[model samples]
Target: MFRTAVGAVGLLAALAAVPPASAESNSDYSVLIISRERLEVATSCEIGVYLNDQLSGRVFQEQSTSFNLPPGPVDVRLRLLPGQMPGCAAGIEDQRSTRLNLQAGQINKYRIAMGHNGLELRRASLGY
Candidate 1:
């Protein structure tokens, strides 16, 4: 009887060492849609969109893209297209990032625009 009790305790300990299921299992996700507003500058270059330090999508002028992400803090970045051209601003090597805390089952909208330093993301209205 003592041996059976000890074995049961060992089994419980082993189970406890295992990690729980991923947050994706029982967690909700947020729908993020990023829109690239049409600007007179750099109309020819396709902007690169990064999520969590990874390239997620490429956006064109007046284009919109969507991503479904788990509820948490997300890192978003934008990369300007390489090379210089007329009407396009120089300095395509600078990178900018924004931290967003998203909620589950919520829709988040953003607009990417050309700033003095680089590309920036701003919370936008629904119709924008």
Candidate 2:
């Protein structure tokens, strides 16, 4: 009985030393914040946000979205999504993508704006 108790205690101690499998850490990821709060674009269309060519999220006027991406280069493409608005049809705007190098534990912000060419992302400050 004493030997079984000792073994159980040893097993309990070993289990306590190991980290829980569900205890995930976000330190390896970076945050990307895209905001459309500025009136520079002046459009009622919802903007489609693509990560590596995959449609991830959407943002409208005075709105924003954030993504937790892994550390590396991410291809961010912005396009006006077809919606209820008459002028929000697809293929009405440029489809250029911007490549951003994201670092771990860093937060990068950008504001959608209408550049000379078309819709583009401009580096923005931390707050709106």
Candidate 1 deviation (Cα RMSD): 6.7
Residue 9 local lDDT, model 2: 100
In candidate 2, how many Å is residue 39 off?
0.8
C-alpha-based local distance difference test score of model 1: 0.81
By TM-score, how accurate is candidate 2? Answer: 0.80
Clashes of each: 0, 0
lDDT of 1 at 60: 79
Best by lDDT: 2
Lowest lDDT sum, 10 consecutive residues, model 2, at 87-96
lDDT of 2 by residue, 1-128 (tens): 99999999999999999988784477789999999998988789999999999999999999999999999999999988999999887875667799999999999999999888788999999963
Kindly give the stretch of ten consecutive residues in candidate 1 with the minimal lDDT sum. 83-92
lDDT of 1 by residue, 1-128 (tens): 99999999999999999998866633478989998765633567777789999989988778889999989999999886554545445464666589999998888999887778777887888873
lDDT of 2: 0.92
- C-alpha lDDT of residue 1 in model 2: 100
